[model samples]
Target: MGPLPLNYRRPEYVSEEDSRQEENSADFYDKVDASLQSGPSGTSTGIPDALTFDKIINGGTCPPCTVRDFMNYLIYIEHAAENLQFHLWYRDYVKRFDAAPASEIALSPEWTQTMEEDTIAKIQKDAADKAKKVSPIAREIFRGTDFEKAPEIRVESRDPFSTPPRSSSGDSVSLSGSQATTYVSQEGDAFFAAGVKQPFTIQPFRSEINRVIATYIVDDSPRQLNLSAREQKAVVRALSYTTHPSALRTLSQNIENTLRRQAHPNFIRWTICNGNPARVTFARGLGVGTILVAMTGSIILTLSKAGRGWRALFAILWVIGIATLITAAKGMCVVLHGLHHRHVRPWELFIDDNATGIEQLCEGKRSFDSFDSCNSYEDEPWVVRYQRRFYVRKVFDRQVWIQEPVLRQIQDTIFLQSMLLALLGGGTLTAIFLAVPAGNFF
Candidate 1:
């Protein structure tokens, strides 16, 4: 939000001149500054009304931005990509911790206390056995005395062997967050046996925890988070006791809240300005062609001195042409309105001859029959390969599909605008034409 890094360069380029201008543009900076400010959670998306931040992140199939796209934005635009990386890593770590072995869970402080209690009980039992061997008269004398009562060791609040908290469906509640998540295994859950109060410091987990601390917790480390001294110390202290996932719960929640409040709404706004490209070149071409058809029809009707009804038919052309033109101007397509799919751009499909050796691969290759022989060139998913390229691709690229609710709402609004424009323009023109005689030159 402060002045963006001076080294910042535009990630996507349409032309050299545009890119050059954009890099030094004050307007671009202003737009980014506005996006960073928190206000109504909505941009083009009517947030909390139609779509919420949770839907933006977890909306199945149609989230406004893919996690990859969001990550790229975080990396290139927001420069806080580490928050997302840590958040995702912590989620997976929780799952792994929950599924850990009994031996590993036993390493927790609560379980250690349980084991110590058992040892003490065993020692007391041996003392009682020795007491039993004493003379009957002495045992009888002590049995009736207040001194015969064994001192009770009270352990408060925590029992490692107690069952974990459960939801109505009996699934083990996730200890990390307010939201209930089922991570319970088919076997007796180790989570309950270990207890959530103390840290878990098991072997492999200890190494992994150390790695996390080194990478994310240390102030001088690369991608070190903006955690406070208190929060950092608490996490380290809890983790030292055990490798339990709950140790990092405070840190994870803080980052998640930051993302939801600051990063996420801004991302939705960013998509409205950039990611929601509703149409490509082909659709624009169609719009241009339709406008031409409408012009031609108008010329023919005027020359023919057609009947009033025939002249009135020009409204149909008026509606179609005006609507098409509006969509074209907005980079939207009526046919694809409310649709999550898009045509693959011709350039996306073409392999750069300079970048990759497609020319060499085609050298001795014959068509039709020996196509299978060209299997020497291994193929990776184009999406994966595309991500590796220099360009930060938008969601609207060829073969790309997004069912994002915000995007869909924007398209719906555009479509409605087009229809209203068509109606008002066509209706006004039809009314004027009807007022005059069709055959006259008035």
Candidate 2:
């Protein structure tokens, strides 16, 4: 048959099924490549590009890429699980409350009472564990056991205006260690007292009052009645003589005036208004002045030199001066003031004062109009004004701008870039210095 006529034998033909299989193989390989390109951790290797569709479709393995894809999938699944868990818990809580009767709902707590108990216990245990972990470091820093031996002060107030002593029996208050006591006179001949023990010291009574205010704002439940009782008495006594409008106004105006007189006018304004100006003209001016002085000095030095080589030196100096000026101009001051009051608001100083003021303001009646009304001279408009002013001066005016963590990260990046530029400039200067002849310098 003479090797059979070339066209005589039936050509080996791919069946429709075979062709379909090849297409499927190609599709599978394409998907794998796409997956590898968009792999987690961002960067991708090109090794997968050489893969044949048929090999991948036929179950040829790509271990590294497969492992990475699996990890990425797992991460997505984990996040989804967390989201589902949160939604489920929220829905359950809502449903449980929604089905109850109106009276029952009213009496029912906003938070799940049972869950809250468990959560609180868990939180306490976690906190204790965390504290135990840190206690060693704390002990090292403190370096002494004298904290245990320090006497505690018990404060007792005799009059509304009198400062409370740490000990009622003692003549002088001992302000040592964590255990301290202070006393303040309450309304209508009553006395207010507090006993602070170790690891806890009596901060200013204002802080305690603020905490109470914050608690009332967040959760005004009768469950906090005990906390309210303790805090109300203290706050009422503290505010009895302070927070008058006249007092606040005088104090605030004093702070405003003092801030306005500062050498840095913008800074002063920021202190007073708690507003950040878009441009700090004074700082920029100083930077510009510094650069000008540096450039002038460099020019004078260049003029004194006898050779053309001096031109290179002057150029280097100019570049450095300009670069430094730019850096200074771009760098942000971390500590900046914002428009927020430094001192506690007249209302914030005492909850009782705030409540009484609001009631009086709304009703157009004076506290003295009714004996049943808890009225004090401290609630006078003048006193409130003075209190506001005092807080502005003492608290708000003293505040400075600080870099947040995110801003600090940006600064670090800038610093790295600047460091590289400095190194390059230094290297260029050194090379020029080494290449130039000594005779070129006069």
Candidate 3:
């Protein structure tokens, strides 16, 4: 009578309402557990775990996919990201230091000889530990990206210029080259024979020395790559020695200016430069997607000309078109670049794909590396041998296969000589588009 008297026990019965309540409770707990497991930035890892090289080399998380936690591709991506950010670091922090009237670029804290030795020892030890952590099985797949030293620019004989010869009397002959023939330089600038034909004067000799320095660097490395300190100093010293003592001041100025240009970041990258033949052909096929995007934007811009929304839409669509064209043609991946990984090849190229390799990979595979040991999350790494065989058996005709080669093409230096005309053409179209009414913009 009064919600059951203390002496009278209520009888138990199953109800649909009870089941629904239990299910909701379970869902809430599941969400809380997921949040606790998630890394900073609300991602599975601060960087999306899917973005890792493991996913690229293996495949997705479905039954057919194989996953690797510590892949060589991941190492490459980390360094590539660091290198790109380093240029941005120079442009912001380092450049600012250079410009400040009172503030010079600060050096690392001074260390005694013993301290320096200790620091170097620590770095070596850390590298050794990382090498050991992956086990010998991962050694082939996980080539360490932590470089002891970045590559330096080496001076080669007669670089960026024809050989300088001496007259019969032993007096130095003037530096010479054909002005009519086109010359493509590191920065992708092309000089026609006509433009440079009448340029044998001592005037702008500083520029000549700077251009000469450009030719010394190896082309394998991208332009965004920085030179080591010793190399930089050596470059300045060499240029100084070549110039007459009275002109040493001018030579120093030349070196300083040249450093900026030499270190400028790449705006575009070509897949053909770093990718194989299959990858390049695949990249060209993506042009259709860009066309579709442009057409969609055109339709929206035409229909929405009634208000300021159309103006904003036009700009957005135009920018998208520009980016799409560059990517479809040049094969640049901002994501891969930021991660510092070049999607050039598969992990199999670097690893052993035998039964032993599979056993080693599966030995301690786990979903999250730093999470609880008892956790049941499963993240079995792909057996390289099995995965490769699967792709080959299917002839790799899967829908996802198309993206594989395209990623490899990104991060190329767009040949400015070839793209110069295209850029001008785009600029003119953009100007005309911006000026015209939305419906008539095309």
Which structure among the candidates has the greatest TM-score?
Answer: 1
Identify the candidate with maximal lDDT.
1
lDDT of each: 0.50, 0.31, 0.31
Per-residue lDDT of 178 in model 2? 22
Report the lDDT tens digits of candidate 1 across residue range 179-248: 2122122101222322323333344376666556555554333455665332343444455555666667
Sort by TM-score, best first: what order? 1, 3, 2
For model 3, the superposed segments whose C-alpha errors exceed 4 Å read: 1-288, 303-305, 308-317, 327-332, 344-347, 355-427, 438-442
lDDT of 3 by residue, 99-164 (tens): 544321122122234533453344344434533444455455555755333333232221111222
lDDT of 1: 0.50
TM-score of every model? Answer: 0.41, 0.22, 0.23
Which structure is stronger by TM-score: 2 or 3? 3
Q: What is the lDDT of candidate 2?
A: 0.31
For residue 258, give model 1's deviation from the true position in Å: 4.4
How would you encode candidate 2's per-residue C-alpha lDDT over 130-224 as one tens digit per residue?
A: 33453556667766666432234232211211222334332222222222122111111221222211211222223332322222111221111
Give the lDDT of residue 239 in candidate 1.
54
